[model samples]
Target: MKTNFNKEWKKDRIGSAHSGENPMVIAKMRSGFAAIGDTQFLPGYCVLLPSKAFGSLEELDFKQRSEYLLDMSLIGEAILKVCNPRRVNYSIYGNTDAYLHAHVFPRYNWEPEERIPYPVWQYSGEKWRNFEYQYSDKDHGKMKEKLSNKIYELMEKAY
Candidate 1:
């Protein structure tokens, strides 16, 4: 039977990270986990999920909030380095999932002229939700490796 992957991932992200079940995870940060997005339509899309389950960023203490934002920026920079997008967009919206997480999307200049300047959400529902955009091990492995290496390199330079 096919599994509800997102549900399963959300059930035990920490444990999955420790056990290596969640392949999207790139690195662990002080306040959260950095992971590549399951969808690669935008190339280096990624997310920063809080280590401890929290409803929203408002629930985090000042230090934790700052750390999460910093980690988000780290992921964005890594994507920028590896994907060479024209710009990176950062968004934190907990409307669907209550979990405190942030999305880092890399925007490319090659995108259609009409869609390039707008949010990714403005794309047609089919384009946004197409299963063809789903991650594949063979296709995405190199991207994951490049992003992971860039993230570690950035972390080293920050220290």
Candidate 2:
């Protein structure tokens, strides 16, 4: 069964036996990073999508899953390196999107407002950064460039 993650990716690359989207256009293991939306509100908001679809991490082959986590770690490193927020948050719940993607978010301790574990749905005077907007196009591209370059550098050195 085709999943949501790969679908959007399909609009972008499909792999061989691999089920990743836009495998060609998408950044390689070491090419760069891709920002989902342009909202600059959150500096390092990225989704390290799996090359293929499996309901959960439990389904992926041990080696492939390990490598993906490593990649995610490298991606996370670049994210924190660039954003430098108070701390970082990683979310891998595939409930809504139903795609194999991980959320790499930079959490700040001194944020203007209080943000809880689950994002509040009501927009009522809520700061959009936590709920909606995060990265803006003008700055996001440049930031993505930095993060992407870092990933590429790490990828080159290792794999």
Write candidate 1's Cα lDDT for 87-158 as tens digits.
Answer: 999998878776778999999988899998788878787765667776666777789888989988887776
Clashes of 2: 11
For each candidate, give its TM-score against the true structure. 0.89, 0.68
Worst 10 residues of 2 by lDDT: 17-26
lDDT tens readout by residue for model 2, 83-152: 7887666778889667566667676665546554544323234344443444443435567677778877
Write down the TM-score for model 2: 0.68
Cα TM-score of candidate 1: 0.89
Clashes of 1: 0
lDDT of the structure predicted as candidate 1: 0.81
